[model samples]
Target: MNQADIVIVGAGAAGLMAARELSKEGKKVLILEARGRIGGRIYPLPKEEWGYEAQGGAEFVHGEAPVSKALLKEAGATLTHPTEWWSVRDGPPSKIERLSPHDLQLEEALKKLTGDTTVAQFLDSNFPAGEHDDLRNFVQSWVEGYDAADIHKASALTLRDEMLDQGSWRQMCIREGYGLLLKYLQDACMQNGVEILLHKAVTAITVNQNGVSIQCSDGLIYQTKRVVVTVPLPVLQTLQFTPPLPKKTQAAAKIGFGGVIKIIIRFKTKWWTGPREQPFERLFFMLSKEPVPTWWTQHPEPHTTLTGWLPGPNAEHVKNHSDEEILTLALLSLSRIFNISIEQLREELATFKIVNWIKDPFARGAYSYSTPESKEAVQELHRPVDNKLYFAGEAICEEDANGTAEAALASGLRVAKEIRESF
Candidate 1:
């Protein structure tokens, strides 16, 4: 049995941040993690495998993420912005225009939205079907692909706010991968006397008048005055609570969780940048209507790697497929998009990796998205139970940063402050 002033379950970004903050106040904190390694969804691949600090999950820093920015600055890390964006249809690829001809009309319709509703409902009401098919497709693709959201459940108000907010348009990539930032937080936690135990999957949590007790899969038990759970929403639903948190459980269900499939392929050289009329040398992003519909390059960094993304329903549809099968599909999509033969791509292929977050037991899914009830759901989850049980994660965040690492870090800091205020 282990004892601590507080026990933080799941040593992800949220857990590590909370531990660091609490430890700063001279409180003993123990973080129990299910995975052997840390960083949670912000997974970093081996440098030797990709020649650079390749990210397996959660790559870009979205918008004005204050917490993420501060941490990167503190860690002496820098950010780089992608230079261009392109889209491919039946023929050649062309640069993407940020605003479409329907922008003014869409903005006016969004402004007149009176009540909360699903994105599907809002789009159907405003854009309709026959006349605005292209506009509808664009909006739906953006919601499902980029946000990994179910249009039938994602909140219209949340999407409206995000689309209108110019800050949300700003994106930057970590020069050395997001792993550096996580390492900084981990080091800070350790330096402050916080203990992190890996592969300690918390099975159950019990809270009573005598404080809280945590039981791990290995049968190890922890006794602490307070407990903070920062596990992903799916994992949280599985945890056994002695006094069942029915309201919190229901609130979690009200919020939306989505999945993603990320495929990374490294080639011997930048074949797409070959001497051609339309060179892909400066390609940042490319969108298509293929099985793997989205692709991007590490622009300005000069890496011979291309990343394929399939999110939301598309990812879920093929979540159970084998790695080789998915790789084949990726190749097919690339072949069609570039009008190149699969034989040529295979010849230049150095290595490849597929990241299916939905299949990951620890993660279950990629990230959270807002539904019509998300606001109320987040509020309910944020309410500490008996001042002994606390919850913190990206799902608990209700702001524009809801699905980013910034949400996780900010929630951790908020929970830490809440715990301190209780004392």
Candidate 2:
């Protein structure tokens, strides 16, 4: 039997951050992870004698969250800001670099969309209920692009409320691998006296007046006074609790994490000739009418290599297919616009990898969102019940929701504070 002051499941951003916070207060914290390595979704790819290749999750410190920025500085991680970054596909990639009033208007619209009502509802109501189909379609495209999901299937209310206020600067990528940052976090946790146990898949959690008992797949029992659950929402749903969660909690879990798939293609040399017909740092847009609508390119890392993105239903469709089939389809899709060939992909493309978070057991899905009928579901998911169990992750963050490393870290710290207040 293992015992600790607080037991954290999942060694990803939320879990690590929670553990770090608790440990800072001198609490004995232990983190159990199913995967052998840390950084649940945030990971680096294989080294083919090139530069930093990212397989799983890879993104830089985003947003103005003090916690995330402070952690980066605490770890001595240096960042390289790209001069030209993030271009949307709707138009010619609006280059209003200095955070203009137009961007703020869009921000207000986003806030109005996500906060009081669903994005779909907000768009519908904003345009006389029957007008502006073209405008609505454009707005939907932008929303889908953000989540890597289709607008119809995602939660409009959740999207409108929680994600709208996050500014444009919230999106950024790391120069090195995202996994490297995870390694730095691991080292920092160790220095802070936090214990991280890998290959520990928590199966069941029982909470009573005494405390919480976590049952693992390996038949190991961990007893602790408090537990912080940082696992993704989908995985949380699959887990069984002794007394069964409340109806609201169950409903919240059913909201489901948005499905996302990222296909990374590393080229021997830069093959893309910039989207704007001009040289820039980052390029993003809807490639075609295919399932994988959006694709983007970033400069080479250490070695000369280019990485592209394929998200949303396009990702779900290709998730189960073979590597060859996926590679073929992706190249074919890109070839349509780029005027490239499959032979070029076979020749110049050094390597390619696919990441489908929905298929991963550790992360059943990417993150959770608010649905049209269930804006309150997200709140239920994050609320800690009985003072014995707490939840933390990108999905549960109240303010800074959506797909950002900062959101995940903020969630961890939030839950840790909850535990501190409870005790």
Best by lDDT: 1
Candidate 2: deviation at residue 127, Å?
A: 5.3
Give Cα-based local distance difference scores for all models: 0.90, 0.67
Candidate with top TM-score is: 1
The list of candidate 1 runs beyond 4 A from truth reads: 89-91, 97-102
List TM-scores for all candidates, in order. Answer: 0.97, 0.84
> Which clashing pairs does model 2 show?
113-160, 114-160, 114-161, 115-160, 115-161, 118-156, 118-157, 119-156, 155-370, 155-371
TM-score of 1: 0.97
Instruction: List model 2 lDDT by residue over 1-423, tens digit each.
Output: 246899999999888888877888778899999999888878677655445545556565555656666776666665655444433434443443532223444456665543454455566656534566655655565555556556655665545433554454455555555665677777767888899889999999999888999999999899999888877777877788888986635665545456676677777866665453645444333334444555655543434354445565556666788767766777776665555677876788877776767688888666555555344666776667777888887767766454567778888888988888877
Error of 2 at 375 (Å): 5.6
Per-prediction tally of clashes: 0, 10
lDDT (10s digit) by residue, model 1, range 354-402: 9999999999999999999998999999999999999999889856688
